[model samples]
Target: MSKVVVASFVLCLLLLHQLASVEADDQMDRTAEAKSDVSEQKIDCKAACAARCRLASRQNLCHRACGTCCARCNCVPPGTSGNRDVCRCYATMTTHGGRLKCP
Candidate 1:
């Protein structure tokens, strides 16, 4: 009877440990998701596009196009122009007339 009791106690402990491990893994996943959300939020499209369009000759057109591209791509390259490689989506977007949509 004592041996049976010990075996049952060990089984219970193993189950508890497994549950705790699963809970820990779930918590880790939630933490990673939250961090990603925060990082995504940190990308301010308005401010980034404003900075990107600062040097353009056509300020209104630049801002409009940059705003659209930034909203779609969630990123802007680090200059007034010609760094489209940094944001592939911005680089590749096309207008109906086959011209690049982004400034």
Candidate 2:
């Protein structure tokens, strides 16, 4: 029982360290983008969210979800809807039941 607990604690620590490192990498990416002059790579969150949810029947819900996701990831697919390939990070985000969470 003690050995199992020690192993679990170590695993948790390792997972947390990995998460912290990933976050640092993401910050670096954001920093690089800020320093770049590429207009195409600069995400206007409002416009991107609007574009992402333009065709949705539930406009309010779509706007809310898309807005949140866009703000967090700075990405949305280059379309009104569907074809999530271009927005890989957004596409892979999931709810508790593993359904796609981004609008």
Worst 10 residues of 2 by lDDT: 34-43
Residue-by-residue lDDT tens digits, candidate 2, 14-102: 99999999999999999889777564465887888887788899999988888777777778887887878887888888878988889
Candidate 1: lDDT of 21? 100
Poorest 10 consecutive residues of model 1 by lDDT? 37-46
**Whole-model lDDT for model 1 versus the true structure?**
0.90
After TM-score superposition, the amount by which residue 37's alpha carbon in candidate 1 deviates from its true location, in angstroms, is 3.0
* Model 1, position 38: C-alpha lDDT score: 78
Which candidate's lDDT is highest? 1
Task: State in Å the error of residue 35, model 2.
Answer: 6.7
lDDT, candidate 1, 1-103, per-residue tens: 9999999999999999999999999999999999998767747878998898888899898999989988888889888888888989999999999999998
Q: Mark the regions of model 2 whose C-alpha exceeds 4 Å error after superposition.
A: 1-42
TM-score of predicted model 1?
0.68
Query: Candidate 2: TM-score?
Result: 0.57
